[model samples]
Target: MTTLAIALGALVLYLIAYNTYGKWLGQKVFRLNKDHIAPSIELEDGNDYVPTKKGIVFGHHFTSIAGTGPIVGPALAVMWGWLPALLWVLFGSVFIGAVHDFGALVVSMRNQGKTVGDIAGNVITPRVRVLFLLILLIALSLVLAIFGLVIAVVFRLFPQSITPCLLQIPLAIVIGFFVHRKGFNILIPSVLSLGIMYLSVVFGNLGFLADSNATLAAWPVMTWVTLLLAYSFVASVLPVWVLLQPRDYINSLQLISTLALVVVGLVVASLFGGAPIDGLRPPLEIVAPAIEQNVTAKQLPLIFPFLFVTIACGAVSGFHCLVSSGTSSKQLKCETDARFVGYGSMLTEGFLAVLVILACVAGLGLGLNKGDEFLTGTAAWNAQYSDWASSKGLAAKINAFVTGSSNFLQSIGISATFAKALMGVFVASFAATTLDSACRLQRYVVQELAGCFIDFKHRKLAEPLKTEKSFQARKTSWLTNKHVCTITACLIAWWMASLPAIPGASGIFGQPGSGGVILWPLFGATNQLLGGLAFLVILFWMRRKNMPIWFISLPTFFMLILPAWAMLYQIFVAAIGSDQSWIEQGRWLLVGIGSATIILEIWMIVEALISWKNLQKTAIQQD
Candidate 1:
């Protein structure tokens, strides 16, 4: 009862703190405007800077920021016990995650929506801009590919998830038609879709459609990989109205509903049911441990670098930084919106991390009373937890906590049964949405890189390629054409994503690590590294704008430095082979990527320095 009270109280306090405290800081320190016009006119005509509502923008920002990284990182952290993970969530958000997110959005907005890359070039250095873009491209591409594998792994294990997952297709198409073709309002379709989506969940639970397909009865890993990729392609190319908007609307509902369940479940279970476990220590010991009997000495004291590295997305994420500058900044209906979208949304994700870890702890406790054989199989254990939760009648409590302060899902009469079933559908749906977003984002990166290199070569070759064929073969001529470049880039991405589709394969394809491992880490580092670099730019820009350094530059500086140090430290561990852990191998691969990024960023910073100096000298001479 005490624990449940504390948990509920903590949640309410955090929400209040984030909304009130965070908002106050944003408004007072930054004086962020909720009404700034997005500088879409300043950029090229792409989907990058489209104006959007706060709710829709929140959906995009939330989905992009919350990926496989958070889930996997925190899930594995459970071995360390819930307390450490919970503390990390609580502390890390206020100091690290929220600042990075908030600062990035504000800086990007002030910079005419030029994106992190352009800001680096203009404020920091020309070389840094290009370097950051390359790193971002490689990092985001790996993210897309790795997350595809993550979705695949989950689906292969849970056959019941398929029918409900596929329900988004027709629902999205219908919503798309109303919004685009029928000129219908977003509110109506969103409301209607949520209702129907709930029904699908109920219908599936009743065995109406869920038990339909024998072929889908048990999907192999490859089938999952294929289906996930296929879904990504369709989702990415479709109108936002049809798929992205409605799907995200329901997801928003689920996110709120699940959060609500967590709170309510904690209260009811702790007070009424007396939480299944108390005084349960983390499975692993810091000393000569029973934790990793099969594990080694170097891997024992999982301290310093490992702890920070393990909590990647929740603490800080480069991907969120990209979304901040790339898409979210441009869509700000007001500058003040950054606080809500940036800090608020990140805190929300941080809260979700806490809730999920709590669920894992609670679920693990219930499993312990059952036996070891049950816990050995991760898939079965997860299923058992769901069943145990349902059996105990505490699922609704957990869902209430997950649903958030809005209780929007509960308002719609979404029952506990449907809410539990809706979780898988929502996870699969969001993953699918992110997969497509990543693909499109990757294509953009490839095209940009091609253009940059092509322009460089074009200048060099112009004198030599005076002949007809030579002129046509110039870099600009070859690479500037969007259609050709886009097709080539998409193919490259598709090929990378398809590697996991091979027969009986279990190794990473491109970035590093085993079983599609390197992708997430690389993405994590690349995203944060970009965030760091963007922070540097923001710091410089804030200084130039005469804004107080404390709120903006200080946060920017920390976001840049902490993760930069974390990545560097991990690289060192990997380089020395200090702990022969699987993560260490992944660490080494990310280190290489990180090293490449630092080199690129340093060079870019230098170029910006030279450019800045030249401009100053020229002005002085003119004076």
Candidate 2:
């Protein structure tokens, strides 16, 4: 029952926070006015900036920000114990993550739906804008490269999940067509699509479909990465309603339903034990230690900075800010919808993280098998979580989540096969959403960068000459074209993913997604820094508008300081200060790139400080 209380308490707290804190931020703080024309309405680009309903916008925003970050981050962080992870997800999501996301959305929406990185120049400094966009380039490339492989790996791990996930594309396209082109009501198509989606899940593992899934799963990882990136390239270039929005919208529905099922399952398992293990039902309880009583060098250390970085998406992730500004901000038809699409989405993700914690620590306690012997309770939890180093890989982390979640579903009379397939599809589909969304976001970043380059080349040209009909001018213009920029994003990611993840291990053919794995070390800190940088933009924007800066300032510093602090620790304490540094491990690439990102972050911060000082002087002069 403690498990039930924890889950219920977290859910209730989110609702209260949404109505109280979230509402206040939208109304009193941000002053989201519905009458203020939105960028989607103002810009009215039928492709990227289509004005969208709040409901569809909410769906797209939630699923895109989610990805596997909440799942993977919380799953890994639990190595420190369930309690720390739970507290962070509960408080962090409400105060930090949701605020970060909400602020980014409103700021971007007010900035004519430009990405925060692009708006950084107007608010902070041009140099900071360039710095921030460079950071976005690296960060998004990491996501695009990593997520394609993540979905591919998910397909391999749970073959039955493949068909349902693949089927969502056409289903979404159909829904998009009827709703947008034909002027059909969205309600009917949505309900019908969801039913068809669940039916796919139901028969996903049966008959020839199962055989097809297995065959697809057996294909090489490189093949899937190639196809997935190609798909992302096309999705990125397409209009918003054609693929990205509708697909993500429908994906969100399935995810919400799965979450509903997990909650119901949790309630059932709380009252009575989960499905029988070897003809004996085992009571579902928190099996993992409240705190890891022992620590090893290879295991995670529960400390101020470590826990914060380890559990990013569940609590606060910089990546969320990009999603806020990049895609959702463009689609929002009204400024009033920012709170629901931004703050509410983070809270929902927080609840999902809570469920993941329960699934790992409690639901795993219900049952698991090892070779010929079946393990229940603590032993089952320990099997996967015995030593952090043992189950630290992507597959291991996902398996732990899937096994535990499937156990939860089983408690509610769900068949074991279907339950696992549902959870598997849930994870894979979410990752796929992130993949496509990142591709689109990356395209925006590239276009911005390209536009800057074009301006530089034409800086000295006369007004009329700037719009030259010459071949050179035409070639430069192509740089900003949506199709070209999207292709650039996908091609860069594909090229990077094709490289060996580990140096001197093999050529591109040896290991899949090697390039991203090599750069994986930088993702956590860099991503968090982005949130801080975004907060800085929001703070400056509010300051310039003469709005209250007190509220936005604290989170800005908190986000800015922590990620840098973590980077310093990893560099000075964990790496250089240690007996066996990264130098000893021969990871020169990590050392070099990580150090570069930190320098870039510091440079941007210094620029911000200068900008703030000038603002203060201007205020004094006005006074």
Please list the residue runs of candidate 1 whose C-alpha ends up more than 4 Å from where it truly belongs after superposition.
40-49, 180-185, 205-208, 211-214, 217-223, 237-239, 274-301, 367-420, 454-489, 497-515, 518-524, 552-558, 561-578, 581-594, 601-623
lDDT of 2 by residue, 460-556 (tens): 6455322344335535588888888989998999888887675566533257654666677668888888889888988999999998878777888
Poorest stretch of ten by lDDT in candidate 2: 462-471
Query: What lDDT does each candidate get?
Result: 0.57, 0.86
Estimated TM-score for each candidate: 0.76, 0.95
The candidate maximizing TM-score is 2
- Candidate 1 per-residue C-alpha lDDT over 282-343 given as tens digits, one digit per residue, 9 for 90 to 100: 22111111132322422323434455556667667766777777667765656766787899
Query: Which residue ranges in model 2 land beyond 4 Å of their true spot?
Result: 460-476, 503-510, 575-579
